[model samples]
Target: MRVRLVEGASLPSYADGIRQVYADVFSEPPWNEDPSAGDRYVERLAADAARPGFTAALALGEGAVGGFATQGTVGFATAWTTPDVFPSGRSYGHVAEALGPDRVEGWLCGALEVDELAVSPDARGAGLGAALLSAVTEAAPDGRCWLLTSVHAEATLRFYRRAGWHQVPVSVPGRAGLVVLLGPGHPAARP
Candidate 1:
């Protein structure tokens, strides 16, 4: 399926479908985010969209998005450039604590940071997730991009690996709860 790249200016037009996909995908398994999580995401998305380099990837299937990517699978992805100074909100702090200041600065700061990528449960195994992921990070500066995912999600970890993301080998210390993955073309990801 084709994944359309929606710039921040046009993201509001796709909010409803994106929220539905977010709720559908995250409400299950390792994420277990509640219905309210979608609400929170919508609110946060506005601020996130305002950030520099904000981009959203939508896989609109006729049945899923009502028109766009509407051939099959309903999946969406979002990403933005990591600020020169890392963020403190959401799980950013946990990531900072886990990787510490040095690695966080060297590997993540200024890189493209994928905030979310969700595919409806019914759409699993259809490759929509990967398509959505590629849509967002395909144009990263120098291919410097990264994201964090739950260590608990084995399949997700596998998916990233298959997509050529290299998992950074760092133990999640204390409450620092995430596994960091560098994109295929990230400079550091190269041998």
Candidate 2:
């Protein structure tokens, strides 16, 4: 697989492939998201990619798009602070508590927030996901990175654990499904 970075404005060309991979992957097991959700997600991707510090990594298999991961240092802050951008204030509130609201942005301000990582079913077990993850997060300032995923995805959790991601303990009532993880050497991991 060939992995490379695609920046803002240039991202739309690959939106369809990335959307297909996203729709397929998230539609399985723990997520089960609908096609319309995927459509909406794709529609928003271009705008999201246009954010300051946005970056995307594409993994191609035999010249065809097979997997992708995206990140934007500034976009995360926008999504977190802007109302309705994420559709769930409850989840962000939980995350803020876990990361310490006052210190959260200080820690993550320039850190890459891995927005999406998806690999086509056909490319599973090929290490494309890991490669893509590594590429996108490596682009972060100071190599600090974080992402959120379904706590119920055992296989997905295992993959991330094997990749050396450290899960942050979040003990919020009613917050059972989502998880936050920090990559190795993140500043927050220091203490």
Candidate 3:
């Protein structure tokens, strides 16, 4: 499998693949109830990738798109100050809090907040997701990387835990518990 960075404008090309991945991975309450949510999620992701300081990566195998990961700068100031550009909804509030004000500055030096990571159903268990995430983690500035995941996603939670992310004492409304994962070499400092 090959993993590489992709542009916002190119996101549309993988819409179907992403949707398939979402459907297969999130086919339960909260996520399943909202059918259109998948499309909206992708749309928001594409828009977020278009913003400054945002980047996206895609993984391909056997001549087909298999997975994707997105990352961007995050912090209290960025959330509270730039809601228009990147809304801080209840779900993302925990992310903003985890990043805090101190880490926002580090963002200029390589700190990045992972926005999304998904692998097509056909690609799961093939290490594509991990490879895509590792690609983003390695590309982050200052080796700082962070992300949030639903607490109810046992499989996803397990995957992240195995990937080195620790449980954070933060929760999102209407979803599940959230956690943040940092790169191995990131300086140990409060967000």
Candidate 4:
């Protein structure tokens, strides 16, 4: 499998695939919700793709999208970023606070805030998820990275933990049931 940053019109193509994954992955209990949520999420992804600081990765096999990851910086100015795109006003404040004032100052300098990651069900355990992560991590502008996942997603939590992401102690307000994950220190900002 080859993993790389997609550019041009192809970005939207991959975004579409990611939207499918979002629908499928969150179709069950815990993160599962109304179809409008997934639709809104995809819309946000499209907007993020057009953002200046955003970065995305795609995994391909036989020339087809196998998995994908999308990340970007989070701060005061862009704190209202994701919701405008995806419209998940429900957990917006929780995520914004987690990725906001506290962590954004130093830890998230140029940080790659993982907005979404999804692997095809047929491709699970094939390292595609890890590959998608590696692509995002390696491409992160500041070396620092972070994400939020439901504690209910035990497997996903384990995956991130094994990938070297550390858990933050704070609980997301609306997403009180979830756990936050952060990556290593900022590349340029580190002494």
Q: Which prediction has the highest TM-score against the true structure?
A: 1
Reference-based lDDT, residue 130, model 3: 76
Error (Å) of candidate 1 at residue 138 is: 0.9
Model 2 clashing residue pairs (backbone): none
**Which parts of model 3 are misplaced by more than 4 Å?**
28-33, 63-87, 95-110, 169-175, 189-191
Cα TM-score of candidate 3: 0.69
lDDT of 4: 0.59
Instruction: Report the Cα lDDT for candidate 2.
Output: 0.65
Worst 10 residues of 4 by lDDT: 72-81
The clash tally of candidate 1 reads 7
- Model 1 C-alpha RMSD vs. true structure (Å) is 3.1
Predicted candidate 1 versus true structure: per-residue lDDT over 117-178, tens digit per residue: 98876666767888899899988999999998888888899999999999988865545357
Global lDDT of each candidate:
0.83, 0.65, 0.56, 0.59
A best-first ranking of the candidates according to their lDDT comes to 1, 2, 4, 3
Report the candidate with higher lDDT, 3 versus 4.
4
lDDT of 4 at 159: 86
TM-score of each: 0.89, 0.79, 0.69, 0.71
Model with the higher TM-score, candidate 2 or 3 = 2
Per-prediction backbone clash count = 7, 0, 1, 3
lDDT of 4 by residue, 1-191 (tens): 56666653466555555665667666756667664565777677666667645667776655333353323211000111222232245565566576675454555434566767766555566677777787766756546676667878888888888877777776777635766677655442333
